[model samples]
Target: MARFRLLADEHQARSPLRQLWREFARQHSAVAGLALFSAFFVLAIIAPLLTPHAPYLQNDNLLLLPPSWSELGLVQYPFGTDDLGRDMFSRFLVGTRYTFGIAVITVLGALIAGLLLGTLAGMSRGVKSSVFNHILDLALTIPSLLLAIIIVAILGPGLLNTIWAIMLALLPQFVHGVRNAIAEQLNQDYVIAYRLDGANNLQVFRRIILPNIWERLTVTATMALSTAILDIAALGFLGLGAQAPTAEWGAIIADSLDLIYVAPIGVALPGLLIFLAVLSVNLVGDGLRTAVKKRREN
Candidate 1:
């Protein structure tokens, strides 16, 4: 079996992505995490078509029903209903879209902003570098959640404002990490050789620095994705994000808290989703880091 697996891997090594997948699949936990995350993401994408009923529609007759597995469960209302008689299963499916969308948008926005700023800071000298360093230091002084709260407070509570706040709060981490990585690469022999070979700053950065730092940036971005999800959920839980009737994970959990005794699954389901999302992202990040380290050593 081992020999056949090795032969199969060698046969599939024609594509870089395939090779990376093989390496990544070696970690059982990472593969499991990826599967779980992908399943949720797919469910979120197709939620509108798959949801049994409108998430916001209320059915007073079915209020506080238990899950289908419970003795009190109804077949039509599989996951049960909220206090307001909204379908829990449908709302949960729809909520996945909101939660995943916010996390992806926030992380991508922060990553782009961080890349631009980090590159500038890393390439700058003397006063320019000093200024950026101080600014990053100031941003990093406060915790990300607190910073997000402050921004949200200033900007007023809303979904877009919450995303922007989370982006701002996460910006310093990417900037700092990327800046140091680029700075180190700048001093390397290849960079010096590129300069000696008459390569311009743009060429050097495009061909050399960017490729080398990509894996690190990917690792950072994956970890940041988890943080973004948590921050958005926190904001939603505190009434600063997504707002009411939006079917967001955190908001769902928050709204169901009052009915814990009557409908524990209402609270537990959303919370479980959040936990799984974070855990999957973290696992993928760890796997990427390990894979990158092994590749570098080889």
Candidate 2:
């Protein structure tokens, strides 16, 4: 009887997750976006094996060479070399690691921090909640990119500083979002019933609030991820994020600006990669929102 009950409990635990996956899979754009992002992640993991040359290795012989298919191109240099004779393809693969790594770190940091602070504010009485919301609103009044830039400037230029700056800039959005979502859930009839039935705050949050608000949280995280990627690239372009010799997508474009007339592909390739990453992320975010809405309606 004990073993059977455990099995039943496990199945019950898995049911909602399974249903969520089914709903998410029904969105074709989400699937495509997930697949493309997964490919980028896989390539990032196996970058050493895929890269023909080191990202920073200068090859004088291959300077300004176009892609392999182009006229006068070499097969060894699949995506050709930049003005500095470094392999574009290798840099791209390696850059994916940095770009994705920073974005993931900042997003997770902001999300976790936001969840904690938001919960506190949401569960608080009138005065505390008002104060928290006021602070958040003040932060939000400054555009995220501008706020990040200001923070980066104060901290000085570097990848680590950029991550911190971006994380801070993004925190207000998450906190505000989570707070409102939590507040709304708290006012729901089911939540009140749970509370009236002698459930503690933690119990109510875990069983009622979290399950209800997680879909919105997932969508917010996805959207923030895309924004982080774009901001990272933008900062790198402005010489405030990834520095010289770093195989970052934005830095690649920044370094290749001088070569635009001579080696147009160098600038074009990294820009294209940035565009695709943001687009895929946005598609996934939109798809998730749509899926969740449809699920709720059904």
Candidate 3:
């Protein structure tokens, strides 16, 4: 028997292919997530072109028209009409913008805030850093929904307020994650040598640690987007999302609570779209994580 074993180049080539196959498998798990979310995104972008009727318009005569392929004139709606006779298809199309918009903006704001706070915490090791960490811990300890609800209740319901509430709620998680990543990266030999060679902390963080650990931060931020989308949808469903007549998915679900039992698809369509958006973001997060890990291994 050999004293030591050698891992050959052939084995390494096979490892990448295995990683590729695993990636493909991950992609397959996320098909439904992609399809539903893509439909909503495309619909939102082309709302004016795709909408058959104004999302806010109502025709009493056609109220509650069930989805029927044959009843073309009487019930032409594919997803059916709501109690107010608003076209389910059109509102659903229009709702995508508010929900997706909240997710994107809130997550971005939180990520930026987190980056700043986390950088400060990672660089300082004194009383101030300890105090900031405790604050982060306190924020994380509170239930996210409770925090959001409180913010909304205090500020009153509206798009801008809701975005602010969500950004505040999401900031702590980002801060904690980035802080950990930066702290770990700071321990590396390169950073140690740079510090010894007269590079200041800011220069090291800005040019060295940040660039290297950005991949990990991006992974967390992508997942955070999915969370923000869900939070916004919940707010809308609870009467805190976009105000009435704006055609938000959550607001539509809040209105159709009763009809959900009657048509099943009444509340389900918007709810399903919300679910799909979160799911798609989650899938993308998973795929990216795996890709990043594989890259690191190679």
Candidate 4:
């Protein structure tokens, strides 16, 4: 016991990620969040294959069936049916695709814009940085969600429209992250040495700044995805996102509001899906961040 205690103490001296996962593994919140999200993502990717019934197909007999503990007994619809008699489970499964789709595109697009603008701004001073930074500052000051609503209003409601809106709204955050990281590294000795070695500006950017900054943006991109997903759902709730019968998580919530009493899981199901999706991405992001920080420290 004494020797074991000494060894344990020595091992505990390592970085947090090494220690954190083991400690966090026992947590139901983290476990359930990861599992739920993985399952949800799989559902989204393989939606066409996994769904037992066509999500859009209507069955009057099964309309408004409550969540089934066992095959709906006689009704046979799982997790009941929506107002239009479409299977809630199947719609929810398919909706994962729509929700994740919007989130992924918006976040990825925003990452590109932020990374380019930020890299340029950070590597520069004088008027160039000022021009780019002013834009970033302007975006940062505005509320992203409100901006999304306005943009979506102009673009009109649709999956692609909401994605574009959210993508624009996400720009400021990436700019902030990218700018900070690049600014810190631009002044490093290695950067100056490379410049002195006759490396062209583009060459310097490719070799020096980007390699170091890549991890930051990667983690940021993942985190942004979570927010983007939420934003998409919000748009859906407001009827500014995926159209009806699209089975998006947010649209599901909007539809369920009218039928909350009749089929609560219609509400719960989508809500659960979104919450889990966001939570999982966040947890994984956290893990990655911790790992990165530890690497930097070491």
Candidate 5:
């Protein structure tokens, strides 16, 4: 059976995607995390239909209502009502859009910008590379949230500004990682051999470098996504991100601070969602990193 399994693995190794999937599937926690993340993503998409009431609708009578399962709760409000009498469940559903949505947009923007800048830095020489590395190092020295705060301070508070701030804050890591990855690949014998074999820069990059470094890129992206989510929420909490009527998770938590004693669950639920989303993304990243390492070793 071991011999057969080895033969099967060898066959799968011919296809990197299949081998990656097989390795990733072996991680139960990662699979669970992927499922959880997918659920949140889907909910964010369908939140408008799933919400029991208008997320912004307010009723003084329902203010601070407990969860449906609680004694003082109503069946109509599963997650209860906020201090403003808006349905907590509805706000949560809508909030998912802001949290995940903004994170996705920020990460993608950073990834694209990084790929372009990192490629240029990696392919350049002397002064260009030095300048790029120095800039990245300077940015890295500042904490992401602090960098975002500085940016938001300049741009003024709002969801759009927060997105730009977080994207800018997250850009350096991707740029540095991609630059290092490409530089490392360029130093390898395979790249040198390809160049000698009449391959142009574009051909070598498309055929050899990208394939070799994609797993690392995937891991970095997953991790960055969680970071973006946290950063967005943090900015929102500080009043430098999504503002009132936005239903963003962090803003929701901020609004609930005054009513924490009366409606502790309001804060707890959004906080829990953020925790879960970050945990899920981290788990996926860990699993991908492990799979990539194992694949390389074998």
Candidate 6:
């Protein structure tokens, strides 16, 4: 009887997650986006094996070779070679790692910092909360990209610095979202019950508040991820990011401007990847929001 009851309890526990997956799967656009993003992730993981040549290796003889299918192209260079004769396809594959990796890292960093600050503000009152709220407002007043650029300029440009800049720029939104969510949750019946039951502030926050607000946080984090990607690309485009031979999508596009006419594929491929990545993340975020809403309604 005990084993049977345990099995039944486990099934019940699994039901909600299964329902959430069903809800997500019902969104065709979200599924498609997931597929696209998964493909890119796979490519990034297998890039070393897939790349035809070292991304930064320059072959003077193959300079500006168009894609293999192009009438003007060499069969050896599939997506073509850049002006410097580095393999476009190779650089692109490797770039998936840098571009997506940085975006994920930046978003996670911002989310952690924001969650801490927001939690503190939400749990406090009067002066402390006011200070946090005002700081968040001040941060929000600056345009995200411009704020990132300013930070990058001050920190000096590099992949790490760019990630930090973007993370800092994104922090305010997460903080604001979390703070509002926690403040609202604190007023809820469940939170009040927990408090009345002699739960400590930390206990109430951990067992009641965090779970209640996690769905909103998940949606916000996904949206923030897309913004981080775009910001990283923008920083790279402006010459304040990933640097030469680094194989970042925006940096590749920046370098290809002069070769636009000579080899349009060089410029278009990376831009297309960036577009697809951002679009995929946004689609996923929308799907998550819809699914969570439906879950709540049920």
Error of 6 at 274 (Å): 0.7
- TM-score of predicted structure 4: 0.85
Model 1 ranges off by over 4 Å: 1-19
Report the C-alpha displacement of residue 138, candidate 3, in angstroms: 1.4
Comparing 3 with 5 on TM-score, the higher-scoring candidate is: 5
Maximum-lDDT candidate: 5
Candidate 4's residue-wise lDDT over 1-298, tens digit each? 9999989987875644555555546555656656766776676788888888898999887777776675553345668778788887778778878898667767888998888777777778898778878888887888778889989989888988888899989988998998999888877999999989999889988888887788788788978888888899999999988888788999999989987887788788788878878888887677666657656665
Model 1 TM-score is 0.93
What root-mean-square deviation over C-alphas does model 3 reach?
5.2
Q: Predict model 5's lDDT versus the native.
A: 0.91
Which residue ranges in model 5 land beyond 4 Å of their true spot? Answer: 1-10
| Native-to-model Cα distance after best TM-score fit, residue 224 in candidate 6, in Å | 0.7
User: What lDDT is obtained when candidate 4 is compared to the true structure?
Assistant: 0.81
TM accuracy, model 3: 0.85
State the lDDT of candidate 2 residue by residue for 5-94, as single tens digits.
999987864676666677889888899998987777676677778787889999777788888999888898888888778888889989
lDDT of 5 by residue, 161-262 (tens): 999999999999999999999999999998999999999988988899888888888899999999999999998888899999899999999999889999
Residue 281 deviation, candidate 3, in Å? 1.3
Q: What digit string (tens of lDDT, one per residue) describes model 6 on residues 75-118?
A: 77899898888999999989988888778888899999999988
Worst 10 residues of 6 by lDDT: 12-21
**Model 3: which ten-residue window has the lowest total lDDT?**
1-10
TM-score for all predictions?
0.93, 0.91, 0.85, 0.85, 0.95, 0.94
Candidate 1 clashes between residue pairs 3 or more apart in a chain or in different chains: none
The C-alpha local distance difference test score for the whole of candidate 3 amounts to 0.80
Question: 1-298, model 3: which lDDT tens digit per residue?
Answer: 2423344544654574465445535666555555655775676577778877888889898878777653643445777787888888888877877888667878889999999988988888989999999988999998666788899999999888899999988888999998999989888999999999999988999889988877788789889888888888888888886788778888888888887777667688888778778888887778768777776676
Error of 6 at 97 (Å): 1.2
